[model samples]
Target: MATTKEYRLGEFTFPRGWFMIATADDINSYKPRQIRFFAHDFVLYRGRESGKPVLLDAYCCHMGNPLGAKNTTSYVVRDNGGTNIEGDCIRCPYHAWRFGPDGKCNQIPYSKDPIPESARIKAWRVVESMGAIWIWYDPEGGAPEWDAPALAEWDDPAWVTPKWDNVGMLAQHPQEVVDNISDYAHLGPIHGSTVDRYENEFRGHLAIQRQCGGHRTLVAADGTRSILHTITTYHGPGVLISDLTGLYDAKLLIMHTPVEDGSIQIWHSLVVKSPSGAAKAGITDAVTAAQFQETSLLSFAQDFEAWTVKAPCINGMFVPSDGPFMKQRTWYKQFYNPRAKERDYLDRCEGVYVPKGVVPYSEATVA
Candidate 1:
């Protein structure tokens, strides 16, 4: 009989950080998209003329009509997409209440008086990286410091990045995806194309070092497996890079955030190291770009079908292939354990589910 290792359910709290919602590609497609998460709605649009990405609440402050009307209003105005903007202001559809990107009510279509500050809906800080957009959930007035973990050849002219593909799995709890990443046994059966040959034998202490950019690198070293995997993660509370085998060979940058309690928004990217004489074979930039876009999408789709039908919460059952899941649970505790003293907080706090929308402050303070 196989020996059972020490594994506990609810053993860790999912890190409370800025979760990535959409990629830069999603907004560039000329669609005014609204992603609802944590019980709030954020609308994404391309900035006028400047072409910077802007994120704000969907409702216009004036009469609460959606600021960017899909398939109709064009979500653009003044060289940008959206409704009318008198000055640096957005107008409402119902009453034309002009508002700025900061969510400040700037004009009243009918009223001559200036709007009170209380009427304004504040805008969240938006950050762009790896061709994606991120927003913070900082309730303390202080935004989470921007942390952009270093990526291999991210800005290199020689490497071209493919447009990202958004994915979703019909299940509650973001932990499921985390579990999927840690569960290596399933790679062969679920994502066998590129992952079938990799082996997961290492079992090492996980140490997370916060870098200069406000992001983190979680290093796991298991001597037995003879493998070292460094997960280059970001402050959007998302994973920015996965340096598993080596620097540029077979790397992945995963941007995942919550859509709701059970649903998730996932965007996956890849950076492949070129091989000798591979260029002459016509493995050109365009070809590699298309491959990353297509393969990553297919991989997530497979996980979607698998996780959606598996279970609502995975902690209820145990599987033999859960060795990696067991290790990942240990790593998640670094986020919420106040005192940062405990190796496992899920054991101390029972019946606790850090579902999205629940205020992170209300939970136990982090050390």
Candidate 2:
């Protein structure tokens, strides 16, 4: 796998952001589920008491046992009670050592000794929203500065149920995936879309791309085209949401979470407005929603195929029509470096390519 230095992103391999670890329905309180992200192992489980999700390092502090593993003899499943988990805390399978949601060891079954302060694993800050579990990660071990995004469409009664596709993982750096936002030249050839207007806007950690175009598709016996107005926004580095208006009022969610130094796990989901305008419209057709989801997956597959097979572009050769690749990349580097290093990158690359009417979100005015 490629490293951060391989892509010339910065010193840090992973960027700071709220990345999706798993869907909410994927985990349960029955047993701890083991997950690997950022090249590290983590255990996720729902708290039996609070009924909330908990995330912590996968290994046990006492004997280096995996907390998620099912062991009949280990105290995790047998000690004090039939199950190892008491409320939200998870017991180590080997020694029955209970660790709280805060990552500190609270109880020891065999010994009457005080738990050592060092008997703790790292507890990650996690939030459940939009049917997914997002974990906040900072290379420097700092807290999240911004909140995860929430869509108003999620709560709207007119929208149909959402559908998700596990696009799976690709062995490439996330910088390569994020680069697609500023890539305007590829719309015509790659996705069969004629771009009327393309622009990129930066607002602190958020990156927004607006594209107005007509997408060509086979609507009938003869090939026909439909005009689509799309506005895509990146909440941080990992999550992207696109609101598209044309034949349908639809929303597409694309999330890329780094599973290793150079690989990312991709997820795609789509939701569309229901034909019937009722809150509990039993009239919404599941078949129509599934068909729309299939079309969305086909459109996304074009980008996914190219990203998986192509060579990594560390320093891309830029052109006038290629969009603001340099500016976007500089903004992306801020997430990988310390807060202090952000200014230097901004100073060097800001104002290089400001869109006609869009204001650049930087401290200094563009020349």
Point to the candidate with the largest TM-score: 2
Models 1 onward score TM values of 0.66, 0.90
Q: Candidate 2: worst 10 consecutive residues by lDDT?
A: 358-367
**Model 2 segments more than 4 A misplaced:** 70-75, 78-83, 218-225, 277-286, 347-367
User: In order, what is each prediction's RMSD in angstroms?
Assistant: 11.2, 4.7
Identify the runs in model 1 with alpha carbons over 4 angstroms from their true place: 1-15, 28-31, 71-82, 85-88, 139-141, 145-152, 192-237, 244-248, 275-283, 296-300, 314-327, 330-367
Model 1 residue 286 CA deviation (Å) reads 2.9
Candidate 2: tens digits of C-alpha lDDT, residues 10-77: 87889999999898888787778889999999999998988889999999988899887666676457
- The total number of steric clashes, by the backbone 3 Å criterion, in model 2 comes to 1
